[model samples]
Target: MAIKVKCFASMREYLDLSEREIGIDGIKTVADVWRSVAGGKPMPENTLCAVNQSQANEEFTVNSGDEVAFFPPVTGG
Candidate 1:
């Protein structure tokens, strides 16, 4: 399956690109995909995850059509 990964803030620098498509087995979870694209580095602490625009988790199973966004936790002004 192909999943869309969007990196934000400092995370974008790690990837050096804002977005990319990753192909994975059907059994993979959100965390699995993140690790692969992250060069084996775990997602940053306090990172926010959303699948298809709804909040999700590391264990959240992804589908081919899902769009995932990873962003640093936002703080109020």
Candidate 2:
């Protein structure tokens, strides 16, 4: 099984990927998903995430076939 990951805006640049599929083995929470693909880099404190389009925290459990998206907080003038 696999989880689809999407990085948006600045997060996409930071992660060097807009989208990728990751194996779900041993991945239980959204944090695990990040750890598996973050290449040892720490997640920014202001980063936000969504699971299946609904807002989720790092501790949110992720199942196989889930879509997880990460993005930096949005700002406007």
Candidate 3:
């Protein structure tokens, strides 16, 4: 199965890319996707995730053709 990953805000800087597609075998969750793209590095704490534009947790199941996005926690004055 294949999934599209999008990194936003500081996540883009951390990952050093805005978007990319990855192929995986066997069952995988949102967290797994993050790890796969992270290249053995740990993900930032409090990072937020969404599946197909809807908020999702790390345990969220990822399916083929799904668009998963990661964002750093938002901050405001």
lDDT of candidate 1 at residue 77, scale 0 to 100: 100
Off by over 4 Å in 1: none
**Candidate 3: where is the Cα deviation over 4 Å?**
75-77
Candidate 2 has its poorest 10 consecutive residues by lDDT at: 68-77
1 or 2, greater by TM-score = 2
lDDT (tens digit, per residue) of candidate 3 on 1-77: 58999999999999897999889666389998988888887878889999999999999999999999999887868
Model 2 lDDT per residue over 38-77, tens place:
9998999999999999999999999999999999997878
Q: On a 0 to 1 TM-score scale, where does candidate 3 land against the true structure?
A: 0.88
Error of 3 at 17 (Å): 1.8
lDDT of 1 by residue, 7-65 (tens): 77877886665888887664367887687678867666788888888888999998886
- Output candidate 3 Cα RMSD: 1.8
Best model number under lDDT: 2
Model 1: which ten-residue window has the lowest total lDDT?
24-33
